[model samples]
Target: MFRVSLLFLILGFTCLSCKSEDKNNVGTTEENIDALLQARYTKLLNYDVDSTAFPRSYSPEKKQIKQVPSKDWTSGFFAGNLWQIYKLTGDSRFKQRAKQWTAFLEKEKFNGRTHDMGFKVFCSFGNGLSVEDNQNFKDVIVKSAKTLSTRFNENIGSIRSWDFGKDRWQFPVIIDNMMNLELLFEATKISGDSSFHKIAVKHANTTLKNHFRPDGSTWHVLDYDTISGQVRGRVTHQGINDDSSWARGQGWAINGYTMAYRYTKDKKYLDRATATADYFIHHKNLPEDGIPYWDFSHPDIPNVSRDVSAGAIVASGLVELYKYTKNDTYLNYSKKVVNSLKTEHYILPKDLEVPFILDHSFGDWSKRHEMDEPIVYGDYYFLQTLLRLKEID
Candidate 1:
């Protein structure tokens, strides 16, 4: 018999209390939702200690990984999310931690040399600390923005990725870079400079023209020759090769374009966001729990691993898309994914040992060690999606 007991338990824990309110009669009230989110936020914040500048992923159940530098980019991403929550709740504790995090990054000499510098510095220093008008942070953002702007090559019309062995090849621009373009845009806003905005627009246009496929899916990486400004190769960082679609890469494109639209108000960006989202939603390969296999084109299904992190990121992007279109379908889809994430497998409830909502996120396919780990990005986006929903309510 299909067990109804487990189903009842899931439903019982899934439905959070909905408080009565006059203004928002359709769903839960904003204040009530904020209170629930605040409780979760408090739990997450309490885990941080002076020994570490930011919250660790979790206390390991087994032997712990060696401690690295306190200023890693992954930790910075979570701090950025926490800063967003602080903005929503107006909590001083969140602000203090955020400040401490930025100070650590500033002192650490974070040069925008890696593809992840945008995710690292832009999210934390640019988005998080900028709101509070911290001069040190403002300078940090300006310096990073200048470094990123300098990375723009007029020949290829896209920012360079890394200083790999050889500089002859123009290298490739990956979809992940979209998250960093906001840094250039912000720089333009702060300095009244058009060059930064121009570079960002060109890069966006180049991605739109080359990176995306007709089916709305995108390549994980695209190599463009610097001298001639021509395409060289398209490859996947997480799949077998260029032909496969890594689910999270697609998620990044969807979320990136949605955010790009917010900055530029370009209808084309929205079109791309919706197109990428459509490809993800319409794909028949999703597991019964709503999470996708790590690679949609992975040869096997039942044997292939799933990435709940992809689901969490895409679910958050879907909510942002809904805000732009005000489409009920998008909102419903976002809610469905969130419900699955909270009830199906990964989410640890209030009484559970862990605080995160999703786990088993794969970071790289080359080495499978990252599989089944609680990725910081997954937790960040999950919190972001829930916070956005609260605002809508």
Candidate 2:
């Protein structure tokens, strides 16, 4: 009997040890990721890049880094990634590098030809402002918001999204515009301009009404009749079809509305965010690891590529939503995504000297461009998600 009791006690201690390791595993994973980022980004900073260009994506086959000009929508994400690393590690090396890269985007504040002012300016300058109170960053942000406000049409109660597709669309308003409202909302707080705030709210209200379906999924593009101020057609610019749910578009909806709720304290925005978040987290097609395919409605399920960018964006959004609601579901799923992304399947090889950290992100899946690659915005949001997780820990 005494021997039996000893064996049971030993088993109990082993179980406790297993539980302890499991509890500490998240921190260990995050530390590993931080070490990886330090090594990879150090190489990136050392690599010679043009003053006019920013790292955009990596081509593994060609072993080439894709660089784009400041006018590119993804131009700010690299700078934002550097700033995020600085925020995560308190490394002044990253902060200085971030400043240099961010400077390249200052001209984009005045370029209002496209609706990506928030993507081009806020991600770089806004992140810089969050790190340090630089007057120049504030000025850039306020001006960028003004430039973005030009795209907003009072008749449509929304912002026009693309300029190149004028022949295909009249007064096109994409669901992705929801992500741009942050710049406007922040402009109000910085410049004491209620005009910016009013425009953001109007855009949000119009998007909330027109973009989402009853199932919480959003159509990618809504073309409006300029004179009638009515949605002329619902279409998909990236998804498998007009009816399919593009994973990243859903992520944009979840993140954007949560941010809107943060600025406005409107429960409608909160409700919309929650609905979309729940739809994403509980979707039948979402992989067990918490990563999702390029489109949830893609018929080719397991055969499709996963979008680490979407996973990172949604993970960051879920962390924010968890803070607001204290919902364990949100926190747990965010943690799951972070854990999945830090693994070998999604993480870039350290020996691969690319500017990006994560891999297998789907960019423009319909055109088969940048498919299953390391995109700069993916790294940015992955880093952002890590920072968010660290804050609560």
Candidate 3:
């Protein structure tokens, strides 16, 4: 299942052949990706979707579109992807559609049960705020940050990542939680409350101290002892095993710490970002095209599925890291990812009726779900990387 079906492969080839003979005459690779996005999302806007449902991924086996309720961690990504496209292309249609989709997620600002406030609120409302000045958007962001802060235990110095699996994990924190700090940092900037910033810094510092191994690879989850304020267990919920590196977790660390550095000007955060970025790009198991296997230490190795979502996330993070370090290595690696992603091998076939723009994103390996599917978050970060590349170009 790692390979696209022969039918889709043929469709992709035909789609590629239909393009203009001169690639430069059409536009830059980034611009072309934007154009493809414009076409695909315009088609998606035409679909009659359920008001309460948000697109999650395309199930190639059942040939059904997977959707989730607004509270789902991925609900905001579709709107965020639309907002990013609008920002990149200045297309008002995308902006209008983005606003409509983003409106459905407003209720999530008060849903504090999960630590994905930034992934939900920030990616949707935060990107909306960046594209246009809306006071309501700013208020939602601040409120969401406050809601997220409720999960932070002062003793643990980290936000609780999962409310489920209580029988297995007591006060568990995942590396993905690091990414939600952007909401806290931005809330402090908007509301002038340093409490949010302080909590974010403490969480980042704690993660720095405990989450990483000597090789710069990260463990996916850490369970903390609330009474003693010490890490009780280090494990992986999504990797090959407890000791392997999950590809997307490393991407989250790079992205999270780079944003932390941007807010605090702390060299430690930057250094952590650099170390993880180096580990990701230079890992012996990484493919030449810059995409990584779902788990770097998987026994299957070259036979494993590639996670385009991870590549897209890391590329966008490196784009930001490059802005700070002025290091071409970071930029070049990002460019390689972007270039590989824009090719027909990764892009959704033109004749495919799905809403996603790219394919081959592996989502939870432990459950064997969403393997080699076109996921909304993959397209979200793919667009983000495109916009970031355009910004720095």
lDDT of 2 by residue, 1-393 (tens): 001111110010000011112221333344444544455666555545456768899888887888888999999998898898778767687788889999989988889898988888889999999988899999999999999999999999998998877788898888888898999999999999999999999999999999999998999999999999998999988999999999999999999999999999999999999999999999999999888999999998989999999998999999999989999999999888877776555666656656777888999966878999999988888888888888898
lDDT of 3 at 282: 91
List of clashing residue pairs for candidate 3: none
lDDT, ranked from best to worst? 3, 2, 1
Q: Estimate TM-scores for all models.
A: 0.82, 0.91, 0.91
- The Cα RMSD in angstroms, rounded to one decimal, for candidate 2 relative to the true structure is 9.4
- lDDT of all predictions, in order shown? 0.68, 0.84, 0.86
lDDT of 1 by residue, 211-255 (tens): 988999999888887678999878786675679889999888988
Go through the candidates in order and give the C-alpha RMSD of each one to the true structure.
7.8, 9.4, 5.6
Candidate 3 has what TM-score?
A: 0.91
TM-score of 2: 0.91
Error of 3 at 128 (Å): 0.5
Candidate 1 at 204: error in angstroms? Answer: 0.9
Error of 2 at 30 (Å): 7.6
Candidate 2: which stretches are off by over 4 Å?
A: 1-34
Q: What 10-residue stretch in candidate 3 is worst by lDDT?
A: 8-17
RMSD of 1: 7.8
